[model samples]
Target: MRTPPNEAVATDTVDEGAGPERTCVLSRVVRPKDALVRLALGPDGQVAPDVRARAPGRGAWIGVDRRTVDEANAKGRLKGALSRAFKTQALEIPSDLGERIETALRQHALDRLGLEARGGMLVNGAERVEAAARQGKVHLLIHAADAGADGRRKLDQAWRVGGGGPAGLEFPEPRTILSMALGRENVVHIALTDAAAARRVLSAIARWRAFIDPDAGLDGGDAAGPDAGEQIRHEGNA
Candidate 1:
């Protein structure tokens, strides 16, 4: 589908200062490009997710959650919207598009973690994380989904005393996935020491987790106050 240059479709460009904005073709809501998922039309007429928004050609953005997209797809509303946006009804949208999007988002978040790890901005292992958390050197705290309850609480307390937050964000995946992402063994927890790196990682993770279930909490404690990761939700998110 060849969209005209003057069409309403969003481009893959990112503005340097305030960031590029895009409109959700379905919801008609304007939001930052990073806060929405992009759907790229391939040469074979297949509509695939461009999670990083770097795919060539024009793309359609969606701000709704996964369930909403699935519902719209089932009712043909999503196809109609895409047909209008791309000006072509020959596009093929997989029945499992929601699952594909979720998978892409999960991988993107893990990739962000791996990048930060390689850059030496984060520390893993319970002991190291706890020590750093106690000293206020930790900018972000994270725990595996299956991490022990007592262990999480201990780390949470330490982070709080060190001027962190009430609790750390819980990764959607278990320790095995997280271990592989950071190239570590039996990794149950992580502490990012750099503020910028922490924000980058959390931004990636928030989109992934929010898409799966918007009402779900990202952390495993009393969410009475805002944590470092929680701030991403309010930072121009839909």
Candidate 2:
């Protein structure tokens, strides 16, 4: 989703230039450096969320998730945001643009995290991560590229729910998983979100970690690890 130096948006919107000069299509509210995705129009004129921001031509941005994009498209906010961002002619946004964007983003997330895992940037399981942190060898906290709501919340809590408080506490966010930029199905892992190669995830996926309730504890007002002899996903959804 990058253009060039002085270009509108090329690198996932994580840069300092992206701050204070942007607004969300769904919120219509300008916000700071939080999670947001950038999209660019393809040569065919169809729009796609430029996961890597390497697409040609001017860039158009959209907030993550399908409903927001649909809302923008319906209310002309999608075009509005684009026109305002690019200062150009009308761009044709397809009805299925959301799905296409989502698919592209998901694939990117999966691929990047899969690579990180292979490159030894990932170490799953809470106990393992806890050990790494204890050893002071943990450089980041990456959630899965495909983590669901429940899992995402748990991981978030683990980040800010530190021993003392949220202040100065480090939250593990892999670059590939960044500010919550990329997403995919059935995948959840973390990597160095600040790294150049992993910069893609910092702007997109990292911010989601902040919004979700830390610890994603549980839904029940009364419950303790569920009933006995009840398997979780290995058996069925609780």
Candidate 3:
């Protein structure tokens, strides 16, 4: 999951190299930063995810799910904090705050992809995956690793045009990632990104992949999360 800095500290720690652990507000225990998303009430009094964590104002941190937030809201933790920070009791938390945040984050991620493309991040089409494989230009395969057999075959035909990946490469649903990340459309042919973005994307996929993989670890991940490295092989297909 993509988490902002620690929420327990309740402030932006974007460049804080305090090592892997930070404190959680709800639990009051230091934990991995990856476990939370920083949220701050905007000027309009709407709660949103602080993706960049640069928003000015006193921020409150929380895990990136609705249940925890709902719990905090019920208990008035957020209410008290807001009352103290803005020095007023007249504020509103949107009824659909979680959905709102999800939508915003998704849009931001998609925008970043466009920004990357505008900045010269290449996104090779179906045919280029093969070429990328032979020339080692391929850093990732952005296909629906779980698509139907015929769809996979057709895509693979185009995918192997250049020396693409191996015979049995797999992928994930580009649209799903787009929806989750709030992008333009399905992200079927994404190129590799910088280490930071790539790590975040890959980790998010791990949780998704674990849901469908029968062999997922207890933590519900397979590391890179069902990328092309693992291809399906039937008894007679070689």
Task: Indicate which candidate wins on TM-score.
Answer: 1
- Span of 10 residues, lowest total lDDT, candidate 2: 229-238
Segments of candidate 2 deviating more than 4 angstroms:
1-35, 63-65, 80-90, 125-127, 142-203, 207-238
Question: What's the TM-score of every candidate structure?
Answer: 0.87, 0.50, 0.54
RMSD (Cα, Å) of model 1: 9.2
The predictions' CA RMSDs to the true structure, in order, are 9.2, 12.8, 11.3
Question: Which has the better lDDT: candidate 1, or candidate 2?
Answer: 1
Model 1 TM-score is: 0.87
Instruction: Give me the candidate number with maximum lDDT.
Output: 1
lDDT of 3 by residue, 106-203 (tens): 44445554454555544544444445433434333444434345644554444344233322223333456543443334444454323234333333
Error of 1 at 81 (Å): 0.6
> What is the C-alpha RMSD, rounded to one decimal, of candidate 3?
11.3
lDDT of each: 0.77, 0.43, 0.43
Name the 10 consecutive residues with the lowest summed lDDT in model 3. 3-12
What shift in Å separates residue 227 of candidate 1 from its native position after superposition? 5.2
lDDT of 3 at 149: 58
